[model samples]
Target: DTAVSQTPKYLVTQMGNDKSIKCEQNLGHDTMYWYKQDSKKFLKIMFSYNNKELIINETVPNRFSPKSPDKAHLNLHINSLELGDSAVYFCASSLVRGGNNEQFFGPGTRLTVL
Candidate 1:
């Protein structure tokens, strides 16, 4: 019974290619997020969806898009993959109960651009 899971834990592709990663959470949370972790281990939130409403970080590039079909699923799509995009992407979900929010993170998807 995995609470949160992501497909294709390892992705290796060319720099110009496009890819999509799927994520699903069984925690019945209304809020889901996409995070990118660089080689330096810095985690940055790219997009967050709460009840199907989107909130994207301003610093995130336009190439990265997050789509949520429903409350339990959030998917990430990356266009024009770059070498700098070679990092780990994490899917997280948390129950927004007034302010006591503790996120559950999915197994990361490591994308390597060659």
Candidate 2:
């Protein structure tokens, strides 16, 4: 079984449409995160939840929100989708909040805004 899993691996939609991506980790990690990888292959942390508490990176837009139903799951909801928001979104989990620990990543959900 996959330690981390995400729903709807591929998504293609209109620019203004809203979208939601769900993530779950079976690793029993205390922290989970959502990351965005742009066309240039640069990865950036969008949001993170530690024990179900949210910790977001300042650069992320307000249109993107992360909800942790539990420590094992973190879902992303995007409102007013934009072309710039198109990217591969990854879900990850770690034993602790920061440093040294290896993070397990999901296969990623590719969002394409037409």
Candidate 3:
């Protein structure tokens, strides 16, 4: 019954490893997105999907990929994880359009690479 949820709230690993974070939403929204917030608190959009179709793809590293099984879920998979990749990954969802539409975020999945 969670609006948005992510697993592995805290992940710590060495460099050059592979990891994944899962996300799900039950808000019945048509669009979902993934955002990365660094230590500086700058939130940047990584990817946005609408009905499993990619709508927005930001300038992100190839090591990161997003997968959407449906309108209510978006997961992130990272390969060759680097220390620079260590950040808080947040899953969000929103309506497709409208001025008042705001993204709802999950608690976040913190990935730490040594």
Q: What are the lDDT figures for the candidates, one per model?
A: 0.94, 0.92, 0.87
In candidate 2, position 17 carries an lDDT of 92
Each prediction's number of clashing residue pairs: 0, 0, 0
Stretch of 10 with least lDDT, candidate 1: 94-103
Candidates in order, TM-scores: namely 0.96, 0.94, 0.92
Q: Rank the models by TM-score, top first.
A: 1, 2, 3
lDDT of 3 by residue, 27-73 (tens): 88888889999999999999988865785555798888888877778
lDDT of 2 at 76: 94
Query: lDDT tens string, model 2, 33-65?
Result: 999999999999998788757888999989999
Stretch of 10 with least lDDT, candidate 3? 50-59
lDDT of 1 by residue, 17-60 (tens): 99999999998888999999999999999999998689999999
- Over 4 Å off, model 1: none
Off by over 4 Å in 3: 97-99
lDDT winner among the candidates?
A: 1
Clashing pairs in 3: none
List the RMSD of every prediction in angstroms. Answer: 1.0, 1.6, 1.6
